[model samples]
Target: MSDEHEHQHEMPATHEHQMGSSLSMAVAATLHCLTGCAIGEIAGLMIATAAGLGNGWSVVISIGLSFLFGYSLSTLPLVKVGVAPLAALSVVLAADTLSIAAMEVTDNLVMVLVPGAMNAGLVNVVFWVGMMISLTAAFLVAVPVNRWLLSRGKGHALTHEFHGMAAAESGWRRWLPSLPTGALVSVLIAFMLGGLVVSIADEAGWQHSSSAAATTRPAQDNPAALALR
Candidate 1:
């Protein structure tokens, strides 16, 4: 009778602990997705804006890059430990798609709703502020979604199982692998795009300012006019 009572008491504790662990795992997973989304979205936006692309094009590019980066980040860890390409892709798509979609929608909506955000220049304070606010809203919205999915053994729960199995098989070898090549490549590409955008914008801005100065200068101040005089 005492043993039965003890088992019953432990059952509730075990369930509670499992629930807590799942919640923590969900939060971590959501954050990982968010980080990738942020990197991709910001890079795309900067690139488009610097290149003088219209707002519609910028949004399209941003969303596309967000998905690419989010999926890449999600799958990289699985592939590093020798998960098959197709299986890793499937798991990442299943685990991160909804969360990434939710975040992208929330953040983009926020940006659209904020006055001047879409048209704001890369150097504008409004642009940075709007991005910060939108990303925060995205994070807030995604957390609940992730938690709900994880509790039901969906979303990141699927990835967690594979990760656990991999860990068991490889022990610490799982952790010893450097960052996945895909992730490193994605980041590098984003940086290159951002740098290209900055260079283009700087050149354009300088040309515009120089032309404006030339047009506004008094004829008396012009070298050609002075030489003629």
Candidate 2:
């Protein structure tokens, strides 16, 4: 009877551990997705700004790149293990599309709502501040989405099986067992890239401003406009 009672007590502990593991995995998966989306979005916005594109075009580019990077990042690991390209793509799409879409929508909406954020030059502090806040909001919004999908064995849960298989085959299961570490690394890399892009954009903005000022005549210096007044 003691043994039976001990086993019963252990069962609840096992169940709780599994639940905790699932939640942690879900958070890791969501973070990974957010990192990819943030990298793509930032890169796209930087390019569009450099090219003098309008907000509409910038948003189009940002959304396109977000999906591309998000899908590619998630799919690459599967493909590396000899999964068929089509199957890998499908799995990535199934696992990450909703999460990516939700993040992008929330981020873009925040950017648009932030006064002058969409129009602010890269050198402007408002632009970077708004981007940071929007990304944070998007992360918060995506977490519950990932958790819900994970609970249903969808979203990132679909990819967990592949991760397990790959880890087992490559003997990485023992060394780097947790997915959260990998996810954190990805997020760090993305932020670093974003900072680099912002630096480049700031330098470019300064050059552009200087060149424009050097070539364009001041309004007060235009005698023809003065005569009309």
Candidate 3:
């Protein structure tokens, strides 16, 4: 055989790696999408605030940016690996967008509906504290749901197909196990619980408008807190 023929014969037809059932892979892929979405949502929220945008606009912009960035982040990783960038991008967009969007709705609605959460002002102790708690909770809920999906290969199927990098070996995967999914679930739970209490308070004629209404307030600087304050 000629040298060209020999070279072609050496490569395997398809690499057989372990991916669980399609359903499992689908779940994992969906979770990876959520991971991207959560990161984007939080980043957008921070960026909008840092820019001194108001609440309603900030959330709208943040959620919008979050979706874009989330999709890009998810796609880029797969592209950087061996997959065709276009195909990888398509798969990620297809698998994760809706699911993450649903989660975002659940997440942001809870934040906005939490009585005076939006209007607590940047300096309002309750508002700032509540945001921190909310972001933390979002992270907490996302991680395990992500990991469980990841383990089964459903959440990240498109990502898993690429040879550019190993999913489980990447920085994202490395940090996942120790992270806080519980805290987010708890915070959301608390928000619901507090809502019930607030409803009761209202029903009993003990309810009053919260001192803080949800407003899109500008941010102020705190050297000690860095951009965080």
Which candidate ranks first by TM-score, i.e. highest? 2
Candidate 2: tens digits of C-alpha lDDT, residues 163-225: 755433554323432334466466666765576577668878989999888766564588987
How many clashing residue pairs, candidate 2? 0
TM-score of candidate 3 against the unseen true structure: 0.47
TM-score of each: 0.69, 0.71, 0.47
Off-target runs (Cα >4 Å) in candidate 3 are 1-31, 50-52, 121-125, 132-155, 163-229
- Name the runs in model 1 displaced over 4 angstroms: 1-16, 164-229
Q: Sort all candidates by lDDT, best to worst.
A: 2, 1, 3
In terms of lDDT, model 2 sits at 0.82
- List ranges where model 2 is wrong by over 4 Å: 1-15, 166-229
Residue pairs with backbone overlap in model 2: none
Report lDDT per candidate.
0.81, 0.82, 0.56
Ranking by TM-score: 2, 1, 3
